[model samples]
Target: MNATDPLLTVEDLNVRFPTRQGVIEAVRGTSFSVGRERVGIVGESGSGKSMTGRAILRLVRPPGEVSARRIDFMGEDLLSLSEREMRRIRGHRISMVMQDPKFSLNPVIRVGEQISEAYRLHTRASRRAARQKTLEMLEAVQIRDPERVYQTFPHEVSGGMGQRIMIAMMLIPDPDLLIADEPTSALDVTVQMRVLAILDKLVQERGMGLIFISHDLNLVSSFCDRVIIMYGGRIVETCRAAELDKAEHPYTRGLLAALPRLDQPQARLDVLERDPAWLKEQSVVAHV
Candidate 1:
């Protein structure tokens, strides 16, 4: 279904939100791409990390305008596509796993129905077949007792179950590229690792590219192949996951310092120092 191709390439993208107060440039000429591998986008709150992901999906709402000199996916310019065309591509070839499952899920609808609806949007399947696949997806994500979980509503399930259901829905279509915008942010620490594991298995087994956007440096360092650290709406550093320990950029080094270590016996964690250079903002490097 993925077509064994380079999935997406975004170049010189700019996103801005117009408010009565002022115009906030959420993404400042950002550029990146995803092959059939895992890439992570990391930044603090209001650093424009999430905005970059949303821009790629063209999910920015009204009052927020997304303009990119070029945004290509599978040799197609996404910015040039009609909303109808984007709708067809969304959830079929490309899917997004939002941060919170409850907000994304329909409270009135059963979880199975919600996922089946996703399947229906892309496939002309009977209710029976879609239902079957829905349950199969739950099981595939390692959720126990698929039948019981399938019929459950958003409120009926725990937070962890809800996140798992979100993963199931996103993966049901076997999307070529998945933009996970802080996918496990809502889950507890224990559940977070489990969900990350599920994602890793899916990416490895399905051969799909993943754009993991999060503020958790440690998690991204371990979960992704390459890390993109954004600051003030721009990419500050790019490095291999393993090389995160040796990130070159000053902003990146500060971010690494900001993480509280387990071994250090200290009364309190030290806040990170921000460089004036990071505040200036600059271009991101694409080594691969």
Candidate 2:
């Protein structure tokens, strides 16, 4: 792909769910473009970050609705594709690593077999070739004993190991874009660093676009090339990662203030005061 070409372009995206209480707008008119670079979506719970990722894959189930003026991927309209076509693209071209590995992985299958299945489904590889590829993927994710981990079941492995296996499975097909929804949130700090390093290496080496959805402000600022701050089902602010500390929007500022700082230690961090008007305000996109 050309450097100027966008890998994915989402415009006027909206997600809604009907409930007896009321209709909940999970995401509202969100627009963004991602090239072969890391884009971070940061926000608290119920900010619709995860929903946006799922919508790209058309994963939102019934009772939930996803509408977009255009959800284009590599010049093709994703919203227009049939379910079968979308499935062909989902893992082979665009993959997602969900937050919890326990729920994502198949417990009945062996780790290596599951990974090999993903490869076989996307390619014309034989079972032997797929198994070999799966082993390589396990090593790529820094799995110490790929041979041993290959035979182990999901429940038999540690949380960190299971998470790594999930990543290896997602990347086995060498997707063009990877939407990682809080992939590191469940791991300890040390394991989180390891997982991030593996993701960073793969993204850089393969030149793949990444949508990293997370609530960790500091992690996003340091790890992503650009950041999108979501609030009340909309994007409130967007800026270069380096300039995150200098964010201007009140919601972004409030989020930054809430982060505990070692340099400016506080007995208690200030709670974010939500403004109803923010939901109506347009997204402020600041150039670094």
Candidate 3:
């Protein structure tokens, strides 16, 4: 692929589930692109932020259908690839860091071993080499003692440490794209900033593209180069992070106005006023 091309380009993506109620559309006609830069997808819960990420990776399970006009990654069509071909693309080319490491991590395995195994799986390195690389990655994520953490089980580490370990595992393969789904939602403010710093440094140094999904608008606006706002299963607006405050869409404005601010105190936080029309409106294409 040309260096100027986007690392991933998704067009008219949709995810649907066959439920007892009816066919529920989790994501509706969302279109976006990721270059070697950070792109934030923000919305309230069930607004399709997470579904969009899962669809890009083809992780949506059976009975839950995913269809797109094109899901081009590095000039290849992801939607057209077979299951075997897609497996090679998953961790080797693209990786996802799920929300809540407690559920994502293996309870029976040592944290260090898991990370080492990930590296070994992709590189087919010797145990000694994988171990060395794993330790280096742990330290790179700012773990205090890689030796101790490596020997300990997943339950032994704090939430922040677990998150770092997850990041280390996902990044070990040096994938072209990283999809982080609320990777810091469970951490405190101090720890959250630290994890964000680690991610920021690694992405810049490695020249990898990032898709950060979260419900925190302020966090997205501050950290990402560009922001995509979703509402009712569709992208309502897309803008440069610096220009988020100038977004004209009512859904976007409602979301912004609803946030609590220390500088501008009010009697109570504003409730986001929802419009039925937002569900029927066309999704705004992202500017990569």
Top lDDT prediction, candidate number: 2
lDDT of 2 by residue, 112-224 (tens): 99999999998979999998999999999999989999999898998888888999999999999999999998789999898899899999999999999999988999999
Question: What ordering of candidates by lDDT runs from best to worst?
Answer: 2, 3, 1
Write the number of the candidate with greater lDDT, choosing between 1 and 3. Answer: 3
RMSD of each: 2.4, 1.6, 1.9
Model 1 residue 4 lDDT?
45
Q: What's the residue-level lDDT of 128 in candidate 1?
A: 96
Two-way lDDT contest, 2 vs 3, winner: 2
Q: Which residues of candidate 2, in runs, are more than 4 Å off?
A: 267-277
Question: How does model 2 score by TM-score?
Answer: 0.96
Candidate 3 off by > 4 Å: 1-3, 266-288
Worst 10 residues of 2 by lDDT: 267-276
Evaluated against the true structure, the overall lDDT of model 1 is 0.85
Comparison by TM-score, 2 against 3, better one: 2
Q: Give a tens-digit lDDT track for model 1, residues 1-288.
A: 254456888888889988889998888877777889899999889999988888888999988999988889888899999999999888888988887865789899999999999998799789999999999999988899999988889999888888889889999998988999898887789999899999999999988999999999889998899999888788877778987887766667777776777786533334546643455554446464
Write down the TM-score of every candidate: 0.92, 0.96, 0.95
Residue-level lDDT of model 3, residues 79-158, one tens digit each, is 99999999889988999998895569899999999999999888999999999999999999999989999999988989
Q: Give the poorly placed runs of model 1, Cα more than 4 Å off.
A: 1-5, 265-286
